[model samples]
Target chain A: MKIAHHAHKDIVIPNSTRHLVTVRQAVFDVIQESGFPEHEMLRIALAIDEALSNIMEHAFETENLKAELTINLSLDADEEKFEALILDSGKEFDPGEIESPDILTHVASGQKTGLGIFLMRQVMNEVKYTFVSGFRNELRMIKYAHDFKTKGATNAGTQDHYQNH
Target chain B: MPELKITTKIIDHDITLIRLVGFLDAHTFEELDVVINDLFEKNIHKIVADLSALEYISSAGAGVFIGALAAAQENSGNIILAAANENIHEVFDLLGLTQIFTMTDSVETAAKAFECNA
Candidate 1:
C-alpha cells in the first residue's frame, strides 16, 4: 500500500531533560503511517534523538534551560513516505556534520560514541536539517516503505494493510 | 499529568541504572542522554538501562542507546540494555542492536553480568 493511508501527529514539549519521549511518539506515528518498516521508524527516531539530546546536554548549560520544543509528523499521500520535523529554540548544533562513530567495530570489540547520525542515514531515505531564527534548529527525515519490503498477509497487530517480508 | 517518569540510580558499583518508566520518544529522550552522560563523565564504567517500565521506545530512543554506547566506549565504559518487551525487543533486534548491547531479562542479571566481566 502507498502512503495514501498516511496520518500525522504534532506536539510541543517543554525544553526540560524530562520530556524527550513525548516527542519521539510523535515521530513514531509519522513513520508508522508512512507504511515503512520498523527499521525506518528507528532511523527517523535517531535523528530526533541526536537533535533533542544535544539540546538537553548543551543548550541548557545550567538547569534553567527550560524552553519549548515542537515536533510535527506528516505523511505523503502519493509517495508512500513518512516525515517528521522537530523544531527547538535551543543553541545551534549541526547534526549533519557531527562525525558518527563506527558502531560495528566498537560494539564488536566492546567499545562504543559517534554512530547516532550514521544509523539515522541508514534507515531514512531523506534527512534534512536547518537552523531558523539562529536559535531554532529544525530536523526532519523521510521513510519509504520500499526499503524494508514486506509481503504476505500483514496480520501483525496495528499494520493490517502492510504485509510481512 | 502523570505522563512518563524516569528514575536513575547506581546499582552494584560502577553500573548506573537508568529506569525509564514511560514512553521513549523525542520529548523524554534527551533527559536520558544527559543524565547517563553525566554519570559517564564521572567514570561510571558499566550502565544498565532497565526498560521494564518502558511501554514504548521509538527509533530515536534506540539511537540514544547507540550514541550512549559510543560515548561510554570513549570513556572506557559500556551500556547494556535489560528487560525489554516484545515490541521494544523487536526494535532492538531489527536494528541489530540486540547483538551490539547485551540484552537480558532483568537488571539484576545485567548487573551480575557486568560484575562478572569486570
Candidate 2:
C-alpha cells in the first residue's frame, strides 16, 4: 500500500483586484483536489476572496502603495484540513476589533460594505492574524473537514490567534 | 481578468430584469453598482436580478444589492433576486441576507413578487 502526501501550492501576485479571479480559481482547484465537499469548497473560496479584497481595499489603498506591493499566497491541504496563508507587505489590519454587525440593523442603516470580515469569520474554522512592525502582515485561515460535518461547533475548538511582533 | 456581464430588460413598464453572467467579485462589483444606480436615476426602482447565469458572488457583489435595497423600498419599489444557484444562495445565507432580500425560483416569479407587493 502507498500513502499519499499533502499537496502544497504557492502563488505571488501584484496587490491588485485584477488577479482575484485567477486566485479564486486556483484556490478552488486545490480544495477540490483535497476532496472537500462541493458546498464547503465554495465557502472556502469566498473566505479567501473576502480576505484578499480587504487587503487590497484597506492595506494598499494608495496607488503608490499598490504599485510596489505584492500579495504572497500559499495553499496547503491534506485529508484532514485545508489551510491558506496570505502574506502582504501593506498596512496592518486586525479584523478581530471590528464588531460584527447586526444584519437587520446593518441593512436598515443603508450600509453596503463591512460584511467581508464577517463572512470570512463565519466560514473558516480558524482565522489568525499577525503583524510585524514595518515588515509584513500574515493571515492564516484554516478549515477542518470534520468541522464542516459538525456545523455550528463552538469556537472553543478553534484558535483565533492575533499577534504583533 | 475579472468579468461580469449585465443586461437589462423592461418588464411591464415598471420592473426591469437584469441578467448577470460571470463572476461578481471585488474587481467587478462596481460595474453592478453603476448599472443599478443608473436604473435609479431613471426612476426604475422595481428590479428583478436574474441570477441563473451568475457563476459566483462575493461580499462585494452582495453589497451592491444591500446599498440599493433601501432606496428601492423608499420609492415604493423593490429588488427581487431570482434563480440563484445553490452556491450563490449559500453566500446570501452566510451573510444573513436571505432574510432581508426577497428571492424566488425564476425571473417570472420575481416579477410576480413585485406585482404582489404593489
Candidate 3:
C-alpha cells in the first residue's frame, strides 16, 4: 500500500520546563490525528516527552537558556509510519556515552536517573540523533503502524482497545 | 503546559495513597518526587500510587519512583502501584519496574499488601 493519506505539523515551544505541558499536548494531538490506537499514541507521547525532557535538562542545562524546541510530526499512510523530528539549538552530546541502566542494580543503589534514553529506544521503532550543524541537533523517532495492527486487518480499520494489563 | 495533579490521603497510619492525574513527564515529575520525599522524611514508608487517572508517564516520572524505592524499603515500606493501565504497565515493563515494585489491580489490594508486610 502507498500513502493514501498524510499530514504534517510543526510546533515551536520555549525551551523551559513550563512549556513541556504545551509541547506534549501539541504532539499528542498530532499523533492522534494520524488515527493510531491509544496505546501507540501513549507510547509515542512518552517517547516525545522523554526526548524533550532530555533536551531541556541536558542540552539547555540552564533554567533560562533562551532556546526553543522545534518539533515536526509527519504521518504517512502509504508507508504506515508516524515520525517525529525534534530539532533543538543546544550543545551536542554523543548518545553513545549513555547506557541503559540495569534496573535491579540501579534501583538497589538508589540511582534515579538514566531511564530516558532506554525508554525512547523501547517506545519507538527507530530513534536517531544527529548534530545537523553547529548548535543544532535533530532527534528523529518513528513508529510503524503494523506494530499495533492485527494480522489481515484493513488499513482503514482503527484499533480501539488497548492491551490492558 | 503539561499538568499533574497529585492528591494524597493517609491510610493505615503511615500508608500514603496518592492519586495522580494528568501527565507525569520530566516537567511534572518533581512534584511527585517532592511529595514522596516529604512522606519519607515523616517516616511514612508505605506509599500506594493510584495511577488510573494518570494519562501519561516518561522516564522522569518512572525515575522518581525508582529513586525513592530504596529509601522506602529501608524503613520497611515500599511504593505500591495500583490500577495502572496497559500504557503505564508497558513503560514500567520496559524498565523492568514490574519486577522491582509491587503492582496490584486495585488500591485495596495494594493497601492490603502493606498490612501483610507490616
Query: Which is the better candidate, 1 or 2, if ranked by DockQ?
Result: 2
Candidate 2 per-residue lDDT, tens place, A1-165, comes to: 334347788999788887898888888778766665545778888999999999999997677768578899999887678899999988899888777789999899888799999998898888889998999999999988777544555653444779999
- Model 3 regions lying over 4 Å from their true place: A1-4, A35-38, A67-79, A147-165
Candidate 3 displacement at residue A99 in angstroms: 1.3
Question: lDDT tens string, model 3, A70-113?
Answer: 43433332236777877777778545357767778988988878
**What TM-score would you give candidate 2 relative to the actual structure?**
0.94
Model 1: runs farther than 4 Å from truth?
A1-19, A28-46, A55-79, A86-93, A104-115, A130-138, A148-165, B1-20, B24-50, B57-80, B86-100, B105-118
TM-score of chain A of each: 0.62, 0.88, 0.74
- Tens-digit lDDT track of model 1 for B10-99: 787667888888776655566777777678668785788898988876555676777677667676667888999876886676456777
Q: Rank candidates, DockQ, best first.
A: 2, 3, 1
- RMSD to the true structure for each prediction, in A, is 8.9, 2.5, 7.2
TM-score of model 1 vs. true structure: 0.54
Question: Residue by residue across A1-165, what tens digits does model 1's lDDT show?
Answer: 354355666665566535555555666665565454555554456556655656565554445435544333333322355666656666665665655455576555543234445555554555667776555666665555664433332222111111111
Q: Write the per-residue lDDT of candidate 2 for residues B1-118, one digit (tens) a residue.
A: 3399999999868999999999999999999999999999999999999999999999999999999999999999998999999999989998999999999999999988888878
Interface RMSD of each: 5.3, 0.6, 1.2
Model 2 chain A lowest lDDT segment of ten = A149-158
| Candidate achieving the largest TM-score | 2
Counting only residues 3 or more apart in sequence or on different chains, how many pairs clash (N, Cα, C under 3 Å) in candidate 3?
5
The CAPRI quality class of candidate 2 comes to: high
